[model samples]
Target: MFELTAALIVFLFPLAYSPGPGNMFFAANGARFGFAATLPASVGYHVATLLVTLAIGFGFETTLQRSPILFQVIKWAGSAYVLYLAWKLFRAHAIDKVGEARPAGMWGGAVLLLLNPKAYVIIALMFSQFLEVAASSGEVIAVGWISSVFTLNNLVAFTVWTLVGGQIAGLFRDEAQAHLLNRVFGSVLALVALWMMFG
Candidate 1:
């Protein structure tokens, strides 16, 4: 139990804190919407991630590690989505134009997770690492526990990011700065999407 806990904490801390598409989105949204407004999206993003990651941990990761074609297909798919999101964001209206209003809620967060490449990669790597670690103990329970820890920690980490984003929201009082922030974030998302697809 101790080993599993330690391993999970170690793996997830770096994984969650590292810059990724999801984190970037959180930052962007936070800057635009405020942390409280982004909470639902943050929660949704983690939940959706939990679903996809569990799937990967149990099945998809191993399959992809084995099949080059399958791996490439998913990679390309992820990349394509990122590019699509980028185009959409590039076209999205600037954030500052709104009259002291928050954007739409958690649904947007869910959508962002579904579109995020960094989320996928984080899951894939965790799956692989946990599987490797679990080999020594020959225990499925350890795997389950570790996965749960990772999931919970992921939620916490994302929430923290959203809070940071919310803090950023306070920095810009005008529409122009907000719009610039949005475009920058959008560009970053597109770049991440490209990495997911082709890299």
Candidate 2:
């Protein structure tokens, strides 16, 4: 149990907080919209995260391992969807005021997490690293506890990124500055999508 707790903090922290498609999307949304408007999507994303973590901890990883082609299909589909999001961000016009831009809704957030290849990989890794085989009771407890910790950590990391985006938006008072920021974030998202496809 101690080992599992330590692993969750040591491994999951970097995994959840590091720059990735989900985090980047939240940041972009925060910059485009505002923190208040981004809550629904954030909630949806974290809920999906919890579900995925539980699924993997409960043995979904074996199913995924047996079907490599299925994983590939998911990777490609998710990459394509992320590319579409990047295109939207790239083409978005700067709003005169914050929170005026249309934000991705709860459904979009759910879909993003459902198809996110990185999320799958991270959950699988967490379970593989932390779950024990000898004790069923301990395993059950660890699953629940670890899943909760992962979900909570994810919520915090994403919210921080969102707030960072909001701060960036606040800084870019001029239309041209905001426009440039959007283009940069959009390009970064596109690159992340490409990495998902080939990396």
Candidate 3:
């Protein structure tokens, strides 16, 4: 079991650790607002991730497979939301003036996950790959176990990115440099949104 879990960890490293939409979202928020302010969004995202990943593992993949259009709708809608956030990030208040903007709430995070096609694809693939491994081990690992690990990995990654973003922003004493940093994060998110939609 430990060996299989180690393998699963290895498989998830790049996926969870790499800067994706979720991680970038929190990082940008942390830069604009703060890490504490982004926690609700993180909670929303991970909770949704847990439910959706389990659903996919339990049989939702069959439904998604049968309806490609459903998945496409989710993709486009989520991408639009991401682009909207990127626009907001582009015009976000600098850290010195953080009171003017509000961080995204729990609902925003949950909706982002629920509508994100890329998340569904990754969850489905994770099940396929890890479940296949578990089958060879002659031991059954529940979907809950896999989902928890994925969620925890993501939380760790998001936390790191958020703190790092905040720390970098903290280093900039001048408002102009801080604003530029926010825009850079916004640009990164814009690119990530485009990748999610069209890449």
Candidate 4:
């Protein structure tokens, strides 16, 4: 159990903190909106993360393993959604613009997590690596610990990235600079989507 807990911390710390679509989206929204405005989406994303983690821990991995095509479909769908987000970010007007340039909301964040191929894969891997079949009680306890760790780590990571984005926004006070930064984020998001689809 100690070994499992240590391994989970080592593995999940980097995975949760690393640059990913979810983190990037939060950062972008934080910049476009503000940290306070991004909270609802953050909450939604973490809720989805917890639910997905629980699902994977409780035998959903077998279901996924049996249906490779389902994985492919999800990958494609997730990629498409990411691309759509990229397009939206790319076309985002000045932050000061009053109409139609709103930041992503709670549902947007939840949907992003629901469609995130990486999130599914990571959760599956975590369970496969840490869960034991015979030790039912221990497994349940481990899963509870894992879920808590994952949620806490994700909250910290997302908040830090959001703060960074807000700082970046401060740096890019000029409308043109902000626009350019938004386009850069859009391009990065597109690249991430492509990587998800093909890598």
* TM-scores for all predictions: 0.77, 0.92, 0.93, 0.92
Q: Please give the RMSD to the true structure for each candidate, in Å.
A: 3.4, 2.1, 1.9, 2.0
Residue-wise C-alpha lDDT for candidate 3, range 63-110, written one tens digit per residue: 999999998989999889998989888887567784757888999889
Candidate 2 matches the true fold with a TM-score of 0.92
lDDT of 2 by residue, 1-199 (tens): 5665676788877776888998999999998888998898988888888888888888888998999998998899999999999998887777455453578888888888888887889888777766763146576777888888888988999999999999988887688888888898899999989988998
Off by over 4 Å in 3: 135-141
* lDDT (tens digit, per residue) of candidate 1 on 1-199: 6786787788688767876766666776676667777778777766776677667766766675688776566566656765665665555555656554455356766666665555666777776677776667654665566567877887777777778877776776666776666677778878877666655
Q: After superposition, how far is residue 144 of candidate 2 from its true place, in Å?
A: 1.4
TM-score of 3: 0.93
> Any idea what lDDT model 2 has?
0.84
* Highest-TM-score candidate: 3
Residue 55 lDDT in model 4?
A: 77
Stretches off by above 4 angstroms in model 4 are 1-6, 133-137
What is the lDDT for 26 in model 3?
84
What stretches of model 1 exceed 4 Å from their correct place?
65-67, 92-96, 99-121, 132-140
Task: Return the TM-score for candidate 4, rounded to 2 decimals.
Answer: 0.92
Q: What is the Cα-based lDDT of residue 106 in candidate 2?
A: 86
